[model samples]
Target: MVNWQFWKRRTPARILRLRPRGELSDAVRVEFPELAPDVRTYLGQAAYLQLGYFETLTRLIRATPDLAEKEALSLAAGAALRKHLALLAEIREEDADPAELMEPFREPLDAFRRATVGARPRETMLTVHITAGLLDDFYLALASGYGERGRRVARILRADNDRRQLAELLTETIRGDEEWRALLSLWARRLVGDTLLVARGALLLDGDGRGEAARAVEPVFTALMAAHARRMDALGLAS
Candidate 1:
């Protein structure tokens, strides 16, 4: 049996590792000269997280027992992986080391995977979809502060259709089953909380010298929570 509790307890320490190291490298500075240093760092960190999200989706697809559901997840995962790679390629074009750029985010991503290792298939799907929505909002917010290249990158990262499919599936699954509705509601809330915790930590990490960046990210957080509540309502779950 998987020890899910152990993974959850270990997540916070991993989240702490996400704090900004401060100061952009010369390569990154040159690569995104039009953008602020904090914006560059935020974009880099968001890209790393996007890569990790796809990796986690792949794992979830493999763990799923239902062939139909697995296929759906596989399609989403493929799309997500392609988008992540494209974003990374763009970064590489800037002469930055993709590996070094993503290295700091590995631990927190790994911790998230471990924490949700034994979740039910539906739970995993819901978490993935919700997380993607939150990320899309975050990227959009940051993209607005950058140049055309940043806007294009953020646009490519949005998985709106995929997230909608998953959300519909989740809604269908929980409908008319009181126990399942209750259980999934709690699970969704928990996942939302965990995601927000990491997000807050990430924002605070960048807050030291980038107070405006932190303030700019606040609306994304609010929008995510509001969207989550609407999703829960759609599923007949308590918000």
Candidate 2:
């Protein structure tokens, strides 16, 4: 059997070596043709996990009033994202059984994972606020560092009035634009590259100045949130 630990150690390097620049979809297809389709689908969703894309998707999701519709969007987006992560895990385990590697980092990763479980639902609320034209710095603070913590902060910020405002935004006018979509898509691709890099070891999450990898990602998420805000304002969705 291929040394599973070697595979785990090598996976990040392999992912990083596959792409130095250019389109991620192209890179992924070239690296693993069998997973190309799934890679494309995951990237689209991962793009949401990207800076502007996630917030935009969240806004779109919040804009819907039907509970079923909202739930479906969350499942669709979240599931795509989850599938991408699963692939990463599979790649990490390709050489050997993953069970062996799970013992070491499982706890911290799991803790962090649970911290972010609220993202899909809370994302609806956060996007709703941005759409309503209210920019809460505290909300930004929570979302700034590792996003899971940010979601926690956003929950605390969601007072009764905040919830009402978000509901109003959802019920208000909406105009879709191609430009915004294109910009968000571009941003998402870059974000995915950065995230993949971190996962595969192109960058360390705890190196010098990297305090926690999640903190490193804060700015990316923040910029994306700002971009979504700008897009909403540009489109006149927000006053």
Candidate 3:
């Protein structure tokens, strides 16, 4: 049986390897409708992603010295955990086992988590902010394709992530140091590749779906990129 509580471990488990998914370099046009994950894959991956974010933020909260910053990180971590539990409730309502649904997605998504883990506290903090922002936007967009259940999910995803304070903290750091500015600017940009990989991985898009994929992916990702720019601009970092 797969351990549903993989989140409790400090190190990621060595799960079964996943089939290769597209990298950012693939220019993977989403070609939605055809590309969206089925309901099970969607809910499973979405819930697990929130749990990953919560875990990462909670670690940051434990390591930081500043009380005020700890409070801010707690807010983001709390928000992520709430979303995870709520999504689990949603899965139960449909008579599906949440862990079973989430199992198939573990390896790839966990790999994505490891790639985004930053060496420094500040860099990790920014990682949570930037990656969370992008994936939430992408999931909310994908929710539209699911129906009434999807509508319910859109509402949950729309909830205040309580992350504004976190972003404010990062923005202050970026404005104060030119070196931090350059390093984090590049770090934030590099995060996009791994992020988009997980986002695309959550979808049902496969070789069979390739013929019309490009046309469908454009609108959702275009909006995602625009939101991403606003986030960077707000941080006074170039996107």
- Best model per TM-score: 3
Q: Which stretch of 10 consecutive residues in model 2 shows the poorest summed lDDT?
A: 14-23
Choose 1 or 3, whichever is better by TM-score: 3
| Best-performing candidate as measured by lDDT | 3
Model 1 Cα lDDT, one tens digit per residue, 35-79: 223433554666777776687778877777878777777777777
In model 3, the runs with Cα more than 4 Å from the true position are: 1-32, 206-211
* lDDT-best of 1 and 3: 3
Task: Encode model 3's per-residue lDDT on 1-239: one tens digit a residue.
Answer: 22222222122212111111111123333333445556666788899889999989999988999999999999999999999998998899889999997886678677777888889998998898889888887887667666778778877888879988898898999999999999999999999877876665554443543455544665556667767887889899999
TM-score-better candidate, 2 vs 3: 3
User: lDDT of candidate 2 vs native?
Assistant: 0.33
lDDT of 1 at 100: 74
Q: After superposition on all CA atoms, what RMSD does each candidate show versus the true structure? A: 9.5, 15.5, 8.5
Off by over 4 Å in 2: 1-66, 81-93, 99-105, 114-120, 123-202, 205-207, 210-239
lDDT of 1 at 26: 19
TM-score of each: 0.72, 0.29, 0.84
